[model samples]
Target: MIGFMKKDIAMIKNNLKVLGVLVAFYLIMGLFGEIDMSFILPFMSIAIMISTFSYDELNNWNSYAATFPNGRKNSVKARYLTTVLIILIMTVITIILSLFISYTLNKSIDLEMTFLNMLAMIFGTALVQSFMYPIIFKFGVEKGRIMILVVIFGTVIVGGLFSSVVDLSKILNFLGVFENHWPLVLIVSSIAILYISYLISLRFQLKKEF
Candidate 1:
């Protein structure tokens, strides 16, 4: 497992030059411009991880990896572990950056609320990958990428119709009940989603030909 993670990390390191340039440029804009910078953390992680999957496919890495000891299981485990680590690290980095941006924009840091928002962001990001990884595992990246777009389109259509018919404000008002414990809720929900996603991905990988 550790070796698998190391391989993935090495893959990330291979792209550090390009990643650094984009991250630096985005941070500069967030620091000086009027952009809401919270999106960068999840956006960068997802984009990079998806590209890593593309690399694996291009190299036919999985077929070779399956020749190793428990490789199929470990590969899925390592990917999820590495992804969680990336997101957690990025969340910390974003919070630190938020300190400066918040102070710059408002002359104050609402530490509590900022932390809560970060929790929410993690849950949201993890939720997306939970839907994404299983598809990518069952179908190669090329087809999975198209499936993802379709899923996103369907979600937007459903969301639009639901919003048009449902009373969202009242729903939100009802959900205010979880405001105090939302952090715990987010943490538990994220764990459950990741666990379920890992199981589904593992199943697909175990059955996958390559």
Candidate 2:
């Protein structure tokens, strides 16, 4: 399990130059401009991980992995573990940078909103991975990429139609009843989604021929 995780981290390490460039750009934007560039790292880490899926497919890593004992299961589990760690590390870095930016600009840190933003980022990144990994595992990355886009577009259309007929404000108001517990709710739900997504991907990979 640790070996598999190291493998993924090793892949990311090879991309350090790109990651450094992104961090440099993020610092420049956040320090000199008013936009909240803190969201960049968390979201960009997801994109990097997705590209790693492409590398895995191209190298037929899963097929080779299946020859090892419990390789498929460990591979999927380790990938998710590595991905979550990356997201968390990126989020933490962003939070610290956000603090510097805020304090530099206003002489104070909005710790509450900063934490809230990080929580939202964690949930959003986790949600995207949960929705993406199963498809990538089942269909391979290339086709799954297109299918994911289609699914997202269809979902947006359906959600738009639903919102047109439904009073979403009421739903928001009801949810606001648990305002103080929003962080806990999001953290729990994100973990649930990631666990479920891992299960689904494991099921697909275990039975797959390659």
Best by lDDT: 2
Give the residue spans of candidate 1 off by over 4 A: 101-106, 160-170
Error of 1 at 46 (Å): 0.3
Give model 2's TM-score versus the native structure. 0.95
**C-alpha RMSD by candidate, in order:** 2.2, 1.3
- Give the C-alpha miss distance for residue 97 in model 2, angstroms: 1.5
lDDT of each: 0.87, 0.89
TM per candidate comes to: 0.89, 0.95
Lowest summed lDDT over 10 consecutive residues: which window, candidate 1?
100-109
